[model samples]
Each structure stands twice: as structure tokens, then as C-alpha cells.
Target: MSSRYSFGGDEHVFVEVSEEMSLEAFFKALSMTNAVRDAEISGVTEICPANASFQIKFDPDVIRPDDLLTELRRLEDIADRAEATLDTRIVEIPVYYRDPWTHETLMRFRERHQDPESTDIEFAARINGYSSVDDFIAAHSGAPWFVSMVGFVSGLPFLYQMVDRARQIQVPKYLRPRTDTPRLTVGYGGCFSCIYSVRGAGGYQMFGITPMPIYDPDQETSYLREFMVFFRPGDIVKWRQIDRDEYDGCTADVQAGRYTPRIRDVVFSLEDFNRDIDGTNARLEETLYAD
Candidate 1:
């Protein structure tokens, strides 16, 4: 649990915090340490359901590699006394997958071509929710996932492991890999690391997508490489599957921008919708001076 800071490279220093470092404590250390300027924290591999750790990328400009190590050591010295006051948040994301494919049909076809029950392709199709995996994720809207890295093709984010009953299996690419698959959703061979927004010749089997533009150069936050990602190290993610109806609903919501409901909108809607019944406030106000 001691702060063990190691130099991963000339530009990046990796600081592995105690598994139990409260979110507040972790951020406090980062802020207090003169070595760390900015940090982009994200979850890493989930070794087990109970034990997971974060892979934090520290900004090397503010903190010298050696100084970072010293500060982390100092933080660890007070680890016992440090109060736990940090609340971690789970970030949910929606993704979609589509192809002229069905798990059953694919299984039958593969069986006709090869040994069906024994083929990895068939097994992968079944266990990975290949047919509607992306659609399913889409329905949930805000399924929690942590953005790990960005640099594959411009704005491609490398995401942490997925939490689902679907076992993370390594599925091979097509005999001739296609150049259109935007993200390579490989869960098995590479331990389920997903590529964000790019398309090129890839040998990894793709599972799903979010067809929208991922990296926008015009935006102020374009190609963000260093920011606090959605998930931390030990957060648990539950993957809920969405049917076709739910998928359509989400698409409709997105088209009208209903998905991005603002805080003010929520407050107004609640008050207006319930004003007559709740009588908390008058529906409208007009003043007449009786001078």
C-alpha cells in the first residue's frame, strides 16, 4: 500500500498507490506533491472481482521523476493517519455492435465449415455476445467504463476491462482483416483492450462501435491525452444488455439531444410539471399596483 513510484519512461512516471487509497487521499497526494503536475487516472486489468488497481499516468513536467518517488514515499509514511474521505464514481458508457450476423446462425455456418462445437470462432460468437453486444451496451446509455488512453489514431481511447457475464475471449481477425473496423474490441488475446476512434487494417476481431465522431479537432478538449478518466482502479461495472426496442429509443433520444439533459432543465421540468399538484409555487406571477 506504500506509494511506489517508478519511472516508466522519460516522459511518463507510473505511481502505483495502495489499493485502498481513498479517492480524496489519492488526489490529495497528487495535488500536494510538487512532482506531479497533472494526472490522468484510469482503471487497469481486473485481476479478480475483489482486487483491481488503477494505472495512473503522471505529468512529468511538474514533478521530476525522482521527486515524484520521494513525495509518494512521504505520502505512504502518513498512510495510516490519512483519513479516507474520497467517494469514487462509476461512469457508464453505451456502445453498439452490428453485422449481418447472429450467434446461432454464425455457429451453424461455422459448424458446417469446421468442427462447430469445437471451433473457437463459434465459441467466441456465443460467449462474447457478438450479435448484439454493441446494441446491448447502447441501451444502458451510461454503462460505467473508464477511458484509459488516447493516441491510437488521433482520438482513439483505450478502455479498461469490461464487466459482463460474457467471458473475455480472444477472437482472431478475419483471414484478411478489414480496413473498416473502427475499433478493435479484443478481450481475450490482449486482455480486452478496446481501441477508440480510428479505422485501418486490423488483425483483431471487432465486437462493437459508437459510430459518432470520436475525436473532434475543433473542440477545446480535442485529443485529450491527460484528464481524469471516468473510472478509477477498483470500480465495479455492470453491463446491462439492451434489446432492439431499447436501442431504437436511445437513437431517438440522441437525435433530439434528450440524452444530454441539463441540471437546469431537470429543475425547471420538475417544478413546472408538478407545480399545480404540489402548489409549491404559483404557475406565473403578475403584479398590479393599487396606488
Candidate 2:
């Protein structure tokens, strides 16, 4: 694939690896950024990997922009030859689909949705060929999604499912943006899924709410003690549907500082996943929830 290189300014180099979002593109970007970080390249201040691209911020005074670009090209070549595997973590995030709060919010914003008469999930289900919202939720929660990027808001993860392109879920954003979104609300727009990191303005079609906080500035819980944000670009997030009782219990645990998200160490191989998507995913799910 041809990659386009451009300068964001004198200190930043942006590289778009692909026009469309794909696991391959994200893996390439992540691998290259990791390699650059490990090399400890002089003057490099930051490396940010996105859905299909990456940007490197550097001190142009110490390393000329042109020289940095050349080094980046060399690193990209090396990354292409490396094994297509990632050492990462799989995190299970609980979600309450059709929760009362989000339902209320959605109802209030019906005029902003494509179908003013139907709920967000109903409209999404109709367009995606699902018979009902229950079927849609089943399909969505059935697969694990990779954290392709963490942006739009700090700790807001843009997720792409591990399934093939044809099986990927897609939804359109609201006809008009909503003035408020509940924190930890799971949303879908375009080909990406995201968890609202904070309660703020959002346009994504809201589906559900997760009780856990993705971006806890206070870092009160064990999981967020070390890092305020729980997700990384390559981490895997599996959304499991929960009942209202379980949701309330989990919320209490979070408030009491007793909730720790289920997480497991894993090595994700792009080659294996591409070869046998279902098998790989089953194995991943097993590994993540194993005792």
C-alpha cells in the first residue's frame, strides 16, 4: 500500500498509511510507532498512532524535519519485514444495552436522529438488516473489538471488530449533534465503535452505557490507579451485555473502589486472525476469561 507523508507543521510529521481503516493499516502504524519509540530517536517528542495513520512530534531544532522523515521511512521498511504480531491485553467491558438513562437521552434527542420516530438502536437495526434491536445487540456483543485509536476525547477508544469487513457493524451518526452524552455510553458511527469517555457533546448513535469510567482523573480504582485511561490503541475490548441488577452492582463496586475490569495478557497475531477469524476470536475470548 502507498503511504502519504505530510507535515502538520515544522515539528510534526503525519503519515497516512491507508485511505480506509483496516486492522492491517492499524497494525502497521502501531508497529512502526513502537519501533520508533524503541529506537529512542533523538528529538522525537511523541508518537501517536491513529485508525489508519500515525504522527510523530519532534524538536525540529535538534532533528531536521527532512532527516526525521527519512528515518521514519527506514523504520517503516523494517516494520514491513517484522512479524505481524502484537503483545497486548484483552479487557472485558460490561455494557447495559437499552439502559434507562441512555433510553431517556435518546428519546429526548429523537429529533436529531435520522428517523425522528424511532430510537437510535431501532433505526440502526433497520438500516443494517437486523430484524430487531435485540438481534443487533447480540451481533454487536458477540465479537471482540480492537482499540484502533484513542482520540476525539481522551480515553475514548475507536474500536474496530476483529471480524471480517462484511461482518463488521456500521451505523450512521445523528442527523444533528446531541448537546450531551452520558459518560461511558457506548456509541457507534461510521465503521467505528466508541465509549464516551466523558459526559459532553457527541453525535455518535448511542446504544448503551457502561458503568465503569474509562477516563477517571482521580484514579480511584485499582485499574485506573496507575493510568487514568484504561485503553491503549492495540488493546482488545469485549463488550458483554448485563442485566440492570448486574449493572447496578457494578456501579456500586466502582463507587466503592472495588471493581477491577477483567483483563488478560495476550499475543495477537494478525496472520492467524486473518487466516481463521472465528477460531482466533474464540481462542481470544477463552483466554481473556480463563480462570
Candidate 3:
């Protein structure tokens, strides 16, 4: 589909690459945004990429709105012709599924769930055609997910799995929003997976908890020293399942200022992934974990 452009008042321009979410659409958005950023377009204050769209904040005084729209159209054409490649990083996120903390929280909010008797994972597993919660967790942690958007909360990443549409896991949010969700809580809603960056009100189905922090105000860790937010749109994330012992160990490491997440720089290609989903994902994980 052709790109659709719209004006957001006089300061922002919104572009929709596709009505639905797909890697191709995201790549297109990323490509166009990167090109505009590289050009150092005058008056462009911020370039934000969403699930399948992007928006640019600018100063109309420095560059006329019509002129900026023309430039964006030009950039969109350039992006269409450019190679389908993304310069991004793969980050390993450790999660302890069905942990006691989140389990208790879910139990307390059971009446707000579709199945008050069953745990969040149990209900999710049953609906997804899995026989047990373990099977559901296995399916979830089996594939890597791409960060399509980072919002709703500071540093919270909305992740879409790098798999065929049929294979994607889908879940519904709580019947009522929870008053409190623990920081680093792993949640799922619709077709996206999310990690809560802070303890706050949430409606997503709570599944697990991560030991490391995704958002730090003080920027204490080495990883957070450069930026308070760890994730950006287009970053690949693999959720690694860990036991309570390992979770505690990682937590201790974080407290001691010694925890560093597993990360690797790799060029993601939409063409290659479209051709071979499993092969591309294997290569991505291997590259990220390689010694």
C-alpha cells in the first residue's frame, strides 16, 4: 500500500505506512525516519517511529509545512528504493515466568480476569491451545520479538514476535485494570508482549517478572549511563527463562552494579526474514549470544 500522510496541527506530520502491523511496514517507517534524521532536516525537532507509522515534530517557522511534507514524500520514495535493512541491536531479557510476586498480584485481581479460578498464564495457555502453562511459556520464550513501539510508560517496549502471523500468540487484557503492576513485570495483550518499566496501573495479562531494570532515573548501571531508556523501536529482544535462583543472582548483581544485559549489533533484513523466518531468527539469536 502507498504511504498516507496527514498533518498533526502545524507542528507535527504523521505518516502511515500500513493499516496493519508488519515488519515490512516497520522497516519502511524506520528507513524513512533514518533518512530524514541523516539529512539533518532543519526545523525537525523529533522523529518518532510507531508500530507501522511515524511522526515528525517540527517548527513551521523554520521550514514551511508544505515544504516539509514535500521533503518527507521525497524521503519516502528514497526509502522504498533503498535496501530492506535495519541497523539494530538484539538484547537478551531474562524473565522468571510464573514467579511468586506476579502470581500473588494476579490472584488478588482474579475477579478482574476472564477466568478467576485459573492463573493468568493458565488461562492464556488454554486459550492459545497449549495444554499447560509450561507449554505456553515455552512457546513464548521460543521465539524472539521485535520492539515495534516504546510507550505507555517510560522505557516500556511493545514487542511483536518475528514469526508468521499464524504462529503469533494472542491474549486479551484484564477485564478491569489493575491498580498496581510490579516493575519489570512481563505482560501480554492482543498480539504484543510488554515489560512494565515501572510499578503502575496496567491492564495487560501479567505473566512474569524480570530482574533487571529497563528504566532508571539515576542511570546507575553502565548500560543506562548513556540513556535512561534501554530500548528503541526496531530493537530485537529475546526473553530468556530463568529460575528463582538465577533471578535472585541477577538481582544481586544489579544491586552491586555489575549486571550487563546480553546485547549484539546486527543488521536486520526484512527481505531475508520474509524468505526464511526460522533461519533468520536462529542467526539473530546466535549472533547475540556468540562468544
* Cα misplacement distance, residue 183 of candidate 3 (Å): 0.4
Which is better, 1 or 3, measured by TM-score?
3
lDDT of 3 by residue, 1-291 (tens): 579999999999999999988878888888888999998999999999888999999999999999999999999888889999888999999999999999989988888989998888888899999988888898899889999988887989999999998888999999999998989999999988999999999999989999989999899876798999999998999999999999999999999989989999999988899999999999998998899
Query: Is candidate 2 or 3 superior in TM-score?
Result: 2
lDDT of 1 at 150: 38
RMSD of each: 12.8, 1.0, 1.4
In candidate 3, the residue pairs with backbone N, CA or C atoms under 3 Å apart (3 or more residues apart, or in different chains) clash, namely none
lDDT of 2 by residue, 1-291 (tens): 667899998989999999898999999999998999999999999999999999999998899999998999999899989999999999999999999988989988888888988888888888989998999998899989999999988889999998898988888899899998998899999999999999999999989999988998988876799989988999998999999999999999989889988999999999999999999999999998789
List runs of model 3 lying over 4 Å from the truth.
Answer: none
My TM-score estimates for the predictions, one after another, are 0.44, 0.98, 0.96
Where does candidate 2 stray beyond 4 Å?
none
Q: Which ten-residue region of model 3 has the weakest summed lDDT?
A: 21-30
- The clash count for each model shown is 11, 0, 0
What residue pairs clash in candidate 2, if any at all?
A: none
Task: Kindly report which residue stretches of model 1 are placed more than 4 angstroms away from their true locations once superposed.
Answer: 1-5, 8-11, 16-65, 76-86, 95-122, 125-180, 183-189, 193-195, 200-204, 210-238, 243-249, 261-291
Q: Compared to the true structure, candidate 1 yields what TM-score? A: 0.44
